[model samples]
Target chain A: MFRYIVRRLLQGVLTFFGATFVVYCLMFAGGGDPIQALAGEKPVTAQQRAALTEQFHLDDNFFARYLYFLKDFFTGNLKSYTGRDVFENVGSALQLTGKIALIAIIFTIVVGVTLGIVAALRRGGIFDTSSLILTLVVIGIPSIVLAPLAQYLFGIQWKIFPVNYTFEKPFVSLILPGLVLGTLSLATAMRLTRASFFDNLRADYVRTATSKGLTRFRVVGVHVLRNSLIPIITFLGVELGNLMGGAIITEGVFNIPGIGGQLYKAIGLDDGPTVITFVSLLVVIYIVANLVVDLLYAVLDPRIRYE
Target chain B: MNEHLLEVDNLFIEFHTRDGVSKVINGVSYHLNAGETLAVLGESGSGKSVTAQAIMGILDMPPGKITRGRILYRGRDLLTMSKEERRKVRGEEIAMVFQDALSSLNPVFTVGNQISETLRKRKGMSKADAMKRAVELMDQVKIPGAKERVKDYPHQFSGGMRQRVMIAMSLAMDPKVLIADEPTTALDVTVQAQIMDLLAELRRDLNMAMILITHDLGVVADVADRIAVMYAGRIVEHADVHALYKNPAHPYTKGLLESIPRLDAKGTELATIKGLPPNLLRPPTGCAFHPRCKYAQDICVTTTPPLLDLGGGRTSACHFAKELLDGRI
Candidate 1:
C-alpha cells in the first residue's frame, strides 16, 4: 500500500506537469498578440508598445516566455497584467472554489445515494417513478437557465437571501448557486446509483443472501449497497472534476469570487497572464481529481491493484 | 412407512407476461420422506426450478404467483406463513443450493464469511463459533487447507470448490432438508462425481432429506431414492429409482431413457426424442408430451391422462399405460 501511494503521487506530479504544458501552449503559442487586445481603440505610440511588450516579457521567444512563466509559477511570482501578484489572488479564489465544490459534493453523495436506495427498493411504485421523473427533469435543465431563475425566486422575489456577493456568510451565499449547480449532478448521480443498485440487487449473490434467510434490510445494506457503491463512486469522481471546470457560469451569476469567477473576469479583460494562470490551475484540479478517483477505485474495489 | 418431511399438494404457479398469464406448474404434487433423496427430472422451462423457488418463497413478485398450492413441511403449510416466519424456516429448517455455483456466491466476500454469516444468523452462533464451524464444514466437504483457505474469496476457488462452499453454507444451519438444484451440472465429469460423493456423505451424516433437481438421468441414478419425470409442468411418472430405471412407464420417460448414450453401445447414433417439449404458454389440450411421444394415439391427443397407480409403489400418467404394460407400444 505504501508503494502504491508513492507510485500514485509520482503519477500525480507527472499529470500536473502535462496539464500545465498543454495550457501554456494553448494560451501563448496558439493565441495571437495579447498586447493588441490590451491596447484596444486607444492608439499607442511605438515606444509605448515596446515598453508594454518588454514589461510583460512578450519581447522574448515563445519558449523563453513559457520557461519564464513556469519558473514564476513554481516560485510564486506569477503576476496579473495590472502588476498584482497572481498567486495570492488565485490562491484565495481556489480556496473559495474548493469549499463550494466540497460542500456540493457532500450534499450530492448523501442525498443522491439515499434517494437512489429508496427508489431502487420501491421500484415500479409511485415513489420510484416520481423520483425517476424528477431526476430526468433536473438533468435535462442546464445550470445556466436554473441559476438566474433560482436567484430571481429566492433572492429578488422572496428577499429572503442576498442575490449578489457577500463573503460575510459564505455558506448562505453558497447555498443557492451551489444547489443550482449541484442539482444536475445530484440528479445524475442518483440515476446512476439507482441503476447500479437495481443491477446488484438482481445479482445472484443478493438472491443467495435472501436464501440464507437474511432480512431485507441486511440483504440490501450489506450485499447490494456495497457492490453498487463502486460505480457511484466512479461517477462522483468524474462529476467532481466536471463541476470544478463547469462552475464558471454559475459562479459568474452569483459573483462568488472563486477560481471560476476569476477565469470569467480574466477572459472578459483579455488578460493573458491571468488567463494562463487560472486555466493552468483548472487543469491541475482536473488532473488531481482524476488521480484521486483512480486511487479511490483501488480502495473501494480490492480487485484493482496499482502494480 | 417413513414420515413425510415435505409434501406438495395441488401446487399451481402462473407467470404474468406481455402475452398473458401462463400456468407454469399445473397442479404439481410430490412428497419426500425423511432422509430420502427425491430427484425431479425435466427439460428447461419445465417448471422444475420454479417448484423449488416457490417452496423457498423466493420467486419474483408481481410476475410469479402461486395460484393454488399447499407446500406442507412437517404438516405445517409453508404457503400460509408470513414473510418473516418463512425466512426463519428457509435457511434453518430447509436450505437450497442453486444450480450455478459460480454465480450464486458473492465474488467479493470470502467463502468462510459467506458460510459463517448463515451459521451466525440461523444458529445464533457468535462470530468465533461460526468461523470455527465454517472451517469444519469446509473440511467436511473435502476442501483442502480449510483453515488457511477460508479467507480466500469465491473467485479464488474452482467451480467444484465453490459448489462445496455453497453446500457447506447450506449445511451450516443443519437444515432438515437440502434442495440441490443441478449442483453438479457446472462441474466437469470428475468434479461432478466428487460433488455427488460429498453430497451423499453429507446427507448420511446430517440425515437430511434432499431434493436433487436435474435433467441428467445418469446423475440421479446413483443418488436419488425416487425419481419424478416432469413433462411440461406436470409430473408424468414417479417411482422408486430401481423400478423407474428398470421399467419406465410413461412414453416420455421411455424416450428419455433411450436417449442416454451408453458406453456399451459403440458406433451407434443415440436415440433422439422427436420434438421439443410443448410451449407452456399454449400447451396441448390433452397430454403435453403427446406431440413428442411415439406411443401417442388419438386418445392421447384428445384426453388428459391422470396419474394412475401401476402397483408396486409406482405411478404413470399415460392414456395407454395398460397397453404399454402389456408389451404393446
Candidate 2:
C-alpha cells in the first residue's frame, strides 16, 4: 500500500509538470501582446516600448523565455504581465473559487446521490420521471445562461438571496452561485448514480440480502448503496477538478472575485504568466483530487488495498 | 402434518412480462420436517431453485406472481401472512445459502460484517456480541483462523471458503429450516465433496431441516434422505433416495438415472434423454416431459399427468407409473 501511494504521488507530480507545461506553451504562443495589453489605451512611445520589451525579455527565444518564467515560478517570484505578483492575485481568487466549488460539491453529493437512489428504486415512477427530465434540463442550461436568470429569479424577484455573491453568510450569499456552478455536474452525478444504482440493485448479492430478511431500506440503502457508491465517487472526484476550472462564468455573473474571473481577465488581456499560473493550479487540483479518489477506492473496495 | 416444519402446496408461479407469461413453477408441492434433508433435484430451468426462492419469499414480485399456493410452516400459511410476519419467518425461521458464493455474497463488505450485521439487526445483539457470534459461526463452519479472516472481504477467500462463509451466514439465525440452493455447484470436485460433508455434518449437529437443491444427482446420493425429481417445473417422481435410484417409477426419472455414466458398465454409449425441456412460455399441451419421453403415447400428447400415489409414500406423475413400478413394461 505504501509503495502504491508513493507511485501515485510520482505519477501525480509527472502529470502536473506535463499538463502545466502544455498550458504554459499554449498561453505563450497565444495571439495578442501582453505588453500592448498592459499599455492599455495610451499610444506607444518607442522608448517606453523598448524599455518594457527589454525588461520582459521580449527578444529571448521561446525556450529561453520559458526557462526564465520557470525560474520565477519555482522561486515563488513570478509576476503577472501587468507587473503584479502572480501568487498573491491567484491565491485570493483561489479562496473564493474554492468556497463556491466546495458548496457545489457538497450539494451534488447530498442531493444528487439521494435523488439518484430514489429514481433508481422507484424507476418509472413520478420522482424518477421528473428527476430524469430535471437533470436533462439542468445539463442543457449552461452556467452563462443560468447564472443571471437565477440571480434575477431568486435574488431580485424572490429576494431570497443577494443579487451578487458575498463572502459573509456564505450559506445564503454563495448558495445561488454555488448551485449555478454545480448544475451541470450535479446532473451528471445524478444520472451516474441512477444508472449505477440500477445495475447493483439486481445483483445476486441484493437477492441474498433480501433473503437475509434485511428491511427494504437496509437492503437498498446500506447494501446496494455502498456498492453503488464507487462510480458516483469517481464522478465527483473528476467533477471537482472541472468545477474549479469552469466556475469562471458563474463567478463572472455574480462578480465574485475568484480564479475563474482571474483566469478570464488574464486571457482577455493576453497575460501569459498569470493565465499559466492559475491554470496550473487547477491542474494541480485535478491531480490531487484523482489521488484522493484512488485512496477512497481502497476504502470502499477491500480488493483494491491488496494491490 | 403439523409436525412438518415447512411445506409448499400446489404452488404455481408465473413471470408476467411484456412478451408473455412464462409458467415457471406449476403445482409444485413439498415439505420439510426438523432434522431431515430433502433434495430437490433437476436440471437448469426445471424450477427447483424457483421453488426454493418461492418458499423463502424472496422471488422478484411484479414479474414473479404466485397464481396459487400455500406455503405452510408449522401449521401457519406463509403465503397468507402479512409482509412483516413473512419477514419474521425469513432468516430467523428459514435462511438460504445461494448457488454461487462469489455473486451471492456482497463484494464490498467483509464476510464477518455481512454475518454479524444480521445478528445486530434481527437479533438486536450489540456490535461486540454479534461480531463474536460471527467469528464463532465461521469457526463452526470449519473456516481456519476465523477471528483474523473475519476482517477479510469475500474476494479474499477461495471459492470453497466463500461458500463456507455463506453457510455460516445462513446459520447465524439458527433457522429451523436451512435451504442450501446448489451450494456446491460452483466448487471444485474435491471442494464439492468437502462442502457437502460440511453441510451434512452441520445439518446433523444442528438438527435442522435442510432443503438441498441441486442438478447433480451424485450430490444428493448420500446426503439426502428424500429426493424429488422435477422436469419442466413439475416433480415427475418423489421417493426415498435409495428406492428411487434403484427403481424409478416414472420414465423421466428412469431416463435421468440411466443418463448418469457408470464405471461398471463401461464402453456403452452414455444414455441421454432425447429433446430439450419444453419452453414454459408456450409449453407442450400434455405432460411437459412427454415430448422428451421415449414412452410418450397418444394420451400423453393430449393430457397432463397428475401425481399418482404408488404406495410407501412414493408418488410418480406418469400414466405408466404402475406398469413401470411392476416392471411389466
What are the models' TM-scores? 0.95, 0.97
lDDT of 2 by residue, B138-222 (tens): 9999999999999999999999999999999999989989999999989999999999999999999999999999988888999
Q: Which stretches of candidate 1 lie above 4 Å from their native place?
A: A1-15, A29-52, B1-3, B122-124
In model 1 chain A, which range of ten residues has the least summed lDDT?
A: A29-38
Taking chain A of model 1 alone, its TM-score versus the true chain A equals: 0.91
Candidate 1 docks with a DockQ of 0.66
Given candidate 2, what's the lDDT at residue A203?
98
lDDT of 1 by residue, A89-134 (tens): 7878887777777777888988988899889888899999999999
Pairs that collide, model 1? none
DockQ for candidate 2: 0.82
lDDT of each: 0.86, 0.89
